[model samples]
Target: MSKGISGGCKCGAVRYRGELSDISSFRCYCRDCQQLTGTGHSEMFPLVAETFQLEGPSREYQMAGGSGQPTWSSFCSTCGSPLTRRSERMEHCLYVHASSLDEPEKHKPSRILYADAAQPWDKPNLDE
Candidate 1:
């Protein structure tokens, strides 16, 4: 198993610790992510739904997603920083922003998703 990883909400109000899953991470250029983050693309770090544990209750907001469905977004109510995103489909697994992890640097992007939605000006630095 890989070394354990940790991280928390932006306001430091909530925290999490767990074994880093072997799942691959990616940069998403979907409209949902671009609008939520005000960027051309957003980062995703997916893992087994049960591998993560939240130390505190998270504040969430449901908004109209790109698919014209209700999407759930959570954050630290105090810090107002993005934390996680959940699909309207109850069966789908949850997705957490890799940046919200306690150790963001520990993550490495494996690829890009929703390339069809990529912005014209958001040239990514492949070296970063």
Candidate 2:
């Protein structure tokens, strides 16, 4: 197993930890991610649900994915910091915002998702 990581929300109302063995990270440019983050994309790292744990007050929001599956997002109710996201369609795994990790650099996305949805001006230098 890989070393564990921990992080919490801006207001300290929510916290999470995971003993990560593996992480599949991605940068998502889907409309849902764009609007939710108010940015061109959102970075995420998926972890096995069984190895993740959380504490403190959090609120959950549910929305339909492009695939018509329900996705649930959890955040700190007090500070509105995005914490975790999961989908019934992706059973057995929970996704954590890459930036929410204590050491964000540890989770570098391997690929981009919904790249077609990316705004032209927001595109990064892929050649790098």
Candidate 3:
């Protein structure tokens, strides 16, 4: 029963709301995340999939995940803002981009994933 959270795309064309899940937030340095965010990694937070609701114009792109399962990246069709990542391997939670939250500061990444795939220029902050 965590507090509810809400957010949307850059252009306000897409919006989502959900109750936070008990799952710890995480930072992912996987190549998919790197390419998606155009950064060293992506900040992600989990929401209870059963409580999640989305609205407005959005699109999704599917790709093979590190687990070799189908993963989908959702974005705002109008503003092209990255919104969420869903994997067939993890269906109970909807992973939302931390930056996409209405209060991005609320996101606190507790662990790092795919650190081995980190780039030299943007190494994972192990100290955090």
**TM-score sort, best first:** 3, 2, 1
Which stretches of model 1 miss by more than 4 angstroms? 1-3, 63-71, 88-92, 124-127
Give the range where candidate 2 is weakest over 10 consecutive residues by summed lDDT. Answer: 119-128
State which candidate, 1 or 3, has the greater TM-score.
3
Tens digits of lDDT, candidate 2, 1-128: 24677787888778899765365678888888888777888888787788789999999999998889999988899898888889998878888887788888677677788988999968843333
lDDT of 3 by residue, 9-120 (tens): 9999899999898888899999999998888899999998999999999999999998899999999999899999988888999899999999997677899999999999
**Total backbone clashes of candidate 2, pairs 3 or more residues apart or in separate chains:** 0
Predicted structure 3, TM vs. truth: 0.94
lDDT of 3 at 79: 86
**Going through the candidates in order, what is the number of backbone clashes in each?**
1, 0, 0
TM-score to native of every candidate shown: 0.76, 0.90, 0.94
Residue pairs that clash (backbone atoms under 3 angstroms), model 2: none
lDDT ranking, high to low:
3, 2, 1
Tell me the whole-model lDDT of each prediction, alpha carbons only: 0.72, 0.81, 0.91
Candidate maximizing lDDT: 3
TM-score of 1: 0.76
Q: Which ten residues in a row have the lowest lDDT in candidate 3?
A: 119-128
